[model samples]
Target: MHIKYTISVIFIVTLVIIEKENNIISKVSDKLSTQLTPILFGPSLSAPHNASADQHEDRLLENSTWSTQQSSSPASASGGQKHILLLATTRTGSSFVGEFFNQHGSNMFYLFEPLWHVERMLSVESGGTNASVAGPAYRDVLHQLFLCEFSLLESFIEPAPQDHVTASLFRRESSQSLCEDPVCTPFVRKGFERYHCRVRRCGPLNLTLAAQSCKQKEHHAIKSVRVRQLETLRPLAEDPRLDMKFIQLVRDPRAVLASRMVAFSSKYKIWKRWAVGEDLPVDEDEVRKLKGNCDNIRMSAEIGLKQPPWLRGRYMLVRYEDIARFPMHKATEMYSFIGIPFSATVEEWIQHNTQASKEVSGVYSTQKNSSEQVEKWRFNIPFKLVQLVQQVCGPTMTLFGYKFAENKDMLMNKSVSLIEERTFL
Candidate 1:
């Protein structure tokens, strides 16, 4: 009996040692495979071997930890449904990024700037930002929309959605999801149905139909610039009915201001006035407003990056510069983060849109020679304003890897890269 007990103990110990060795070997093999494989998504052009920063940038793009682990399967809520919010401010290339999901497939229901109406309604009686009444109002509307409840939205729509139907839905045509099928006129040619709403020749959008479409979709995404703070969205993220994820998109403040100047010339008339070599008062109202905006952006980003309990595995930070430089690559990362397959249809759209034969210009047009668009502002914005922006938005810029320009010459030199390669998460 003693001999048998000794033999059994030896056998058990042997099995334990083998199991430990197997685990170590498996982990090492995975690490080696990951290192050896080329990044799944990266720029078409390779950087010089000697350029360490460029090499680091490529690696950063490859290793984004949007979810706990990268997998081929989609990470979704309990019911196989997902909700995504593309959080960005004006002129931050959100519309361009939003299109990635918009073109995703029949499974995605994308809403473009649905919160524009809420902002417009409250702009007249605004009491500054945080104190403004629009804060809770914006959140409430978004909460309802995520649930496919449109009655709250109808309250804000101009001309009112009578019995939950109206033609005045803000930017209705931009959303292909709203432009097709039961919501849009069915008689139009199949291929052209997406563009039918652009002409407004179709009948009004029935809120009932829109809600039905939203419910039928497997996933939903909304792109909005209205929500100012990340913490304010905690309620939506914690809601049991929704599986919410946020992609906070930011751009270099200098580029944003430069783009806005051209896009909203009338609103930025004061900026143009200061562009003629006049001295800028950093303490003035315009400058203070710019500073405040930067503060808000940086603070919100800080909160998201901290990965608070409600946001863990649900928050992603993306820079517009990275996307502009490598649209398809960044789009792949985003879709992966949201636990969705990056479709070839989105790939084709990026190819066509980013490499336009000629420069297509519009205040809101997504088409551009993407790489060229990143530095276009370096030539357009005066050095004085650039300096002012850096003074006010320095922390935000530094956090997102935007390097400061030492002088006007360095700012204009296309070879001296202003964006650094930094990894978040």
Candidate 2:
């Protein structure tokens, strides 16, 4: 009887040890996977390492629901001026538009693709993109990150009482709590603290400490530019502290397709699947032909129309052609729409920094002068393809005041003759 009792005790002890080991192994595996996996958005692409691994980990911990602290300080909350966010497909001149605003001396800042951070974080948490399918948890995580980034910005500009108190009393306290997750905590804290130091002396107790806590000057603006994460932006629009304007940039679909073919082939490979005839690798030739197709332009227009109405008036559709023809006028109009005064300095900057003059059919190189390249699509594309594009995207083209060749055959014949004449000359 004694031997049987001893054997039962040993069995129970072994089971507990095995269970504990399994839990530890599971946690270690999760951390390793999160570290090793590549972050992806739309397709596989690398994200800028804006923060250190330790900062990222801390950000995650701080963002966890169980980790948050109740607000201990009171600060007045009020609405502020609306921030303008530019949204568009790649190669549609969104960057140029953003640069125009940046030169206009508005408090505006340009961010390349801010939503990538949230997407990467969610992917890590969910194990992969497949697991992050459209769901409540995915939506919630996205929303939280958006809100946290925005709130961090607000704390910098106008520190809440809690922020003020925290910065002053516990100067070493982690600012990662301000962000939804701890991943970006150190970066945020360092940035804000730097800003605070610039204006005032650093110490254990003051509003200046809060202001200097931000690491990046444009943290708020940068966080706002992630258009793919529109769902996150929606709730933020309601906050009185934030006034939001969305500028949806639309271009001829052919131009968009052509540009994407060159610029985003690796990032958006699915585009290659849409190609017809000869199974051509999405190369420069296909990009050029596609650029002149009206159907491609129409598809882009459809995308614009499908967006919410509140986003429409806030959006001003600019044609690549018009921008090329009247750069100053379009620039002026854009500034006015965004409620910023245009200046001679802005004009000079546009002339100096513009990429409208450079030519590359389907490829976008970061080294190319963008302002000079803006309207070069007209010279390289074939007339027949242009007509086909006009035929397909006629309604939208007409709506946007795009002029089409009166006779498709005549235009093609003229183009061919001109090419021959140039060759002979």
TM-score of each: 0.78, 0.46
The candidate that achieves the highest TM-score relative to the unseen native structure: 1
| Best candidate according to lDDT | 1
* Predictions in order: lDDT: 0.78, 0.43
Which runs of model 1 end up more than 4 angstroms from their true locations? 1-78, 125-131, 186-196, 199-201, 279-283
What's the distance in Å from true for residue 307, model 2? 11
At residue 276, candidate 1 shows an lDDT of: 76
Candidate 1 — which pairs collide?
none
Error of 2 at 216 (Å): 12
- The clash count of every prediction, one per candidate, is 0, 48
